[model samples]
Target: MTKHMTRKQLNSRVVDEIDRNLRQAFDDMAQQPVPDRFTDLLAQLKAAEDKKNSGGQQDA
Candidate 1:
């Protein structure tokens, strides 16, 4: 950082740095494969919802 930089310039640089770091962190997370536990939980919820829906339709 330059000592002669104006406050606006310094603030802009800080904001840019923060935006870059956040984007990189989120991009890494997005690239990661879904964990087995998360996939299993989603599948269980879907199955439960399907069963509930079928049961409700039968009652009607």
Candidate 2:
């Protein structure tokens, strides 16, 4: 037996499949932990800002 889908039906099915897969991937990523590298980078940024502020105060 052969089944044929019309253009609209085929497009809807493809869209539904893509939406389902994207939702699943987002749910999986939400459970993961934050990495240490990100924290270290934030700390480095804070240190650089503090140094810049101190230098500006000396110049004034």
Residue-level lDDT of model 2, residues 1-60, one tens digit each, is 459998999999999999999999998998788789998999988987898888853442
RMSD of each: 4.2, 4.6
Clashes of each: 0, 0
What lDDT tens digits, residue by residue, belong to model 1 across residues 1-60? Answer: 756989899999999999999999999999999999999999988987898888844442
TM-score, every prediction: 0.79, 0.59
The TM-score that candidate 2 achieves is 0.59
Query: Best by lDDT, which number?
Result: 1
Angstrom error at residue 7, model 1? 1.4
Clash-forming residue pairs, model 1: none
